[model samples]
Target: MRDSIRLRTRARLAYTACRRTRCSRGSLRELSAVAVLITALSSACENPLAPELCGAVADQVVPAGGAVSVRVCFNDENGDGVSLASRTSDGTVATVTVRGRVVTVTGVRGGTATVTVTARDPGGLSATVSFGVIVPGIVRLTDRHGLMPAWSPDGTRIAFLGRVPETGDTGDGSIFVMNADGSGVKRLTKSISAVAPPAWSPDGTRIVFTTRDFEIYVVNADGSGEANLTNNADWDVYPAWSPDGTRIAFVSDRDDDIEIYVMNADGSGTTNLSNSHGRDDWPAWSPDGSRITFTSRRGDDIDIYVMNADGSGVTNLTNNPALDLWPAWSPDGGRIAFRSGIPFSADIQVINADGSGATNVTNNPEYVYGSVPRWSPDGTRIAFTSADRNNTEIHVVNADGSGEATLTSTAGTVFGDHAWSPDGRTIAFSSNHSSSGFHVYVVDVSFFGKAAKRATR
Candidate 1:
C-alpha cells in the first residue's frame, strides 16, 4: 500500500513537473491537486517502493588531531516517516551522531571516517532510506582480482601481486606492494615466468612468494634482500609462516612428489611433515603454533590431513575423494578452509579441526573454480579467488557460505593465490591491473567505505 502511494505520488509529481506551465513553480492549489490524485491512484493499485524520508551524515573531515562536524542531509524523497538512526561502518559511532538532518562528529583522528544514516518508517518497524559519509586522505586498496591478502602486522603496509595491461604488462603476472591507503605503489618483484601466491610472516617484516618453478623465495618488503628459500630447483611453493615467526611450511617435490615441508625462518632445518608415500601439500599452522593441517593424496583422494609441528604423527582429516587442497586454519584454531574439485570446477570447503563434518560452504555452482581460501582474523568471513565463465574475481562469503559477493571484476586477468590481512579489512592479490609489471595490489576491506576517501588523496 505504501509503495503504491509513493509511486502514484511520483507519477503525479513528474506529470505536473513536465506539464506545460508559464510559471516554473506550481501554486499550493496545484500541488494539493497532484497530491490528492496521487493518493487516490495509489489507493487503487498495488505496488512496492514506498516513498521513504531519511537523513544521513553526508560529509566528514578530520585532521590529525582535530574534531570535525559531520553534515547530515535530510532526504525528503518519497516522504514516509522521519525516525532517523545512524551507524558507523566499522560499528564505532562515537565519531558521529545524527538527529533529523544534522550530524555532529567528535574525537576523530585526522584522516577519513565513515558514518551511515538510515531512516525508519513512521511505524518504526522497517528501514526506509539509507546513505553514506565520506572524507578524504584515507586510502583503500582494492583489485580486480585480489585475494589471500597478507598485511604486515605493523598495520602500516600491504603486499600482494597484480597485473595491469594499460601499464603494458600481461594480465597474467606480477608482484606489488603499496601503503595501506593504496599509495606509494612500489612494484617489489617482476617476472615473465608468472608469479603468484604471496604470504607474509607473523612479524609484519618479510614476504615469501612463489614463481612458475614452484619454488619459494623470501624478499624484504622494501624490495631488497631477495633469497630463494627453496633453492633446490625442485617444484616447491606455497610458503606459509609459523605463528612464532620461526618457520615456513611449504610444498616441495624433493621427495619425488609434492609434499609439505617446514624450514627454519632462514631456509634451514627443512623436513617433510606429510611423510606419506603419496603427495601432500598446503600446510597451515594452528594459531598456537602446535599442529599443522594440510591436504594430502594418501587416501586415494585429495583430502585434509593434520600432524604435529615437527613433521610427525601425520593424520588424514578429510578422508574423502573430492580432491581437497589449500587448507587454511581459522585464527582461533577451530576450523579449516580448503579448495576442492576437478581443476577448474573447485569451490571453497570448510571443516572442523577434528575433521568431524566437512561442508562445502561455498556451494555456488557459479564459482566454477574457487581456490586460495583465507579467513579473516575475526572469523566472520572467508575470502578466496574464484573464476566464472567470463572472468575471474576475488570473492568473499560468510563463514556459513552465505552472502557470496564478488570484489574484483573483468578489468584484467586475476590469477594466482592471495593473502588476507590479519586485521581482515584488506586483500592482497596478483592481477594484471597495470600490465606494465606484475605488482602486488591491496584492496580495502573496511566496511566503512574507507577506500574512496584514500583514492581522492
Candidate 2:
C-alpha cells in the first residue's frame, strides 16, 4: 500500500510537469477550447500588412541632375497604418528618399540603378518591390508617326503633323501639340487633311498650316478659333510667320504659278513678293525680319533666292547648276543652309547671306542624300536627314564641316524634318523607327558632345 501511494505521488508530479510544458490537455473539449482561443487572437491580428502594392510604378529615365517622384500605396489589412522605406541599389546613379509612401529619386550621375521599396507592419512583417531607373544618353519622345516637330517660341510645347491611324481611307492626318519630352499630346485640329507641319506664331498663341485642299488656316494653340487665312481656291501653302508676329509669308499659285506672298497677320494685304515666271516656293524668313529666302527654279537649275521683305532686291544665293532647295536661315541671320542634289542623293550646303562662300557642310560619301538642314539656335551645328543605301537617319554636323555624327542609327528607319528648341538643348524630328509609318521624336542634343561649331566661312 505504501508503494502504491508513492507511485500516485510520482504520477501527480508528472501530470503537473505536462501541464507546465503544454504537452497534454486534460480532455478533448479543453484542448479544442484552447485552440479556439488562440485562433481568435490570430484572427484579430489579421496580417496587418498586404502582400501587393496598391499604386502604379513605372520605369523612369531622367537626365543627370534631374529628379522624379514615385508613389506607392500599401493597404493595411487590419485597418492599422503602416510605414514604407526605400533604398537604391546604386546610389551613385541616383538617390532615393521616402516621405510616407512617396519615393523621390534624383538622378545623381549617368548610369542605371534599381530602387526597392518596402512596406512593413507593426508585427515585424514586411514586403518589398523593385523598379528600374536609367540615365539615358538619348530619350525617344514619341512612338507614333510624328512629322515636322516645330517647337513653340516658349520651348514648352512642340507642334507636329500626326498621321491618324488609317481606318479605311488613306489620307487622315491632323495637327498635334505636345510637351518637349513627348508627353501631354493634344490634338490641335480635328480630322483635317494637313499637307504640311504646323508653324507656331511668334507669340505662341496661334499656329498656321496648309491643308491638302491648298488652303492656309490659322488656329489657336488650344485648338480654338480656327479661321481660314487664305480662302482662295488656288494652292496656298508653306506659311511662315515673320519674327515680329506682324506678317505671314506663304507660297501661293494664285497667279497661275507658285510664288512667294506676304500678308498681314489677319490675312489682309496679300501681295505677291516673288512674282516671277519660274516656280518660286518654300519661303523662309530671316531672323531679323529684314529679308525672305525661298527656293526657285528660275535659272537652268533650281536654286535658293533671297529678297527684301517688300519683294525688291531679289538675289540668287546659290547659283549652282545642281538643285539647291529648302533654304533655312540661321538664327543669327548670318548664313543660309540648303539642300543640294535630287531626292535621296543630296548634300547639305551653307552659304553667306550675301550669296557667296558656299560650302558643303556634309561631304559624306556614304550619305547619298541630305534633306532640310535646320540650324540650331546657337548657329553652331546643323541637323538634317541623311539617306544611305540601307536607310535614312538624322545627322548633325559642325557648321564648319567637321565632326559629322549620325544622331540616330535605327535599322530600317527613315528620319527627317528636325527642329531645334530655342535653347538648342534638344532636337525634334520625325521617324519611322517602329515601322509604323512616321512618328515624332525628340532627342537630347547635349548627349552629342560639342554641338557648337562656328561657321568656317
Could you tell me every candidate's TM-score relative to the true structure?
0.61, 0.67
List residue ranges in candidate 2 displaced over 4 A. 1-136, 165-171, 342-344, 448-457
Q: How displaced is residue 325 in candidate 2, in Å?
A: 0.9
For candidate 1, give the lDDT of residue 377: 76
lDDT of 2 by residue, 1-457 (tens): 4544454455556555667777745554455555555444455454344545675466555545556787877776655567888889899888999998788987776667878888887776666777776653445677666788889999999998877655555436688888887899887777567878788999999999999898999989999998889998898998999999999999998999889999998899999999999999889999999999999998578989999999999998888788888999998999999988776567888899998898989776667756678898888899887777877776777899886655555554555467888988777877666656677766666644522221110
For model 2, what is the alpha-carbon lDDT of residue 211? 94
Best by lDDT: 2
In order of listing, the candidates' clash counts read 44, 7
